[model samples]
Target: MTRPLLDQARIHPAALAQIGSYHTDLIAEVEAAVAANKVVVVGMGLNPFPAKARKILDGQGTPYKYLSYGNYFSQWRPRLALKLWSGWATFPLIFVNGTLIGGATDLQKLIASGEFVRLLG
Candidate 1:
């Protein structure tokens, strides 16, 4: 059976840890965004694995919107701390259910193992 769009989006806590943030507000926002039903996200920069990860997610029945890194950063600068730290510069920043879901590599690992698809279902 096919999984629902919202169900396809999931933000694992481990993934969020990859983001370095002393403030909890943005972290909470990321967690909430990524955990949301549709899992809308911005691909902040050029990354090696995001396309593959997106393909895997698409194949597994998850649908997502990819926002340009430049545009995303321009709009979300206040919430993000790229200048203050390295947290904002990371690629493949995922937002589902109002939460953050790490990078492409992590997502790829989860999908390859079948855990992500199963969770989607």
Candidate 2:
């Protein structure tokens, strides 16, 4: 059988550094949340930031949701719709604790700064 991602029930050092620099307290908080059986949601698309974020979350065993239309929709289409109606599509929208993070870059910054982990709790 393969070894679990979290061996010895602890996070890997390199991964910890990537995620720990942002929020020193985040690891503890996430551990607590998981122990409590709370749900954490991650919303992202196929963009670079989302892809990176998903990678981190996967290692952490955190759950997330993906939202992307891929190459099927163009930016101007929203404008076209607005001319006909008043609706449009947006990007980098991430919601956690009922707050939106705007995009993957923002999440990367947050994770780097350590805020992402604290919020998981």
| lDDT leader | 1
Off by over 4 Å in 2: 1-46, 72-90
Put down candidate 2 lDDT per residue, 22-115, tens digits, no spaces. Answer: 4434334433443444333322333465566566667767776544333324443332322222111334345556445545566667778888
All candidates' TM-scores?
A: 0.46, 0.43
Clashes of 1: 23
Model 2 clash number: 6
Question: Number of the top candidate by TM-score?
Answer: 1
> Local distance difference test, per candidate?
0.54, 0.48
Query: Mind giving the per-residue lDDT tens digits that candidate 1 earns over 1-121?
Result: 2433223136466654644344556545444455555655555444555566577667767787665434443645633543233243566665544445567776777667875555555
Worst 10 residues of 1 by lDDT: 1-10
TM-score of 2: 0.43
What shift in Å separates residue 92 of candidate 1 from its native position after superposition? 0.6
* Error in Å for residue 75 of model 1: 8.2
Query: What value of lDDT does candidate 2 attain over all alpha carbons?
Result: 0.48
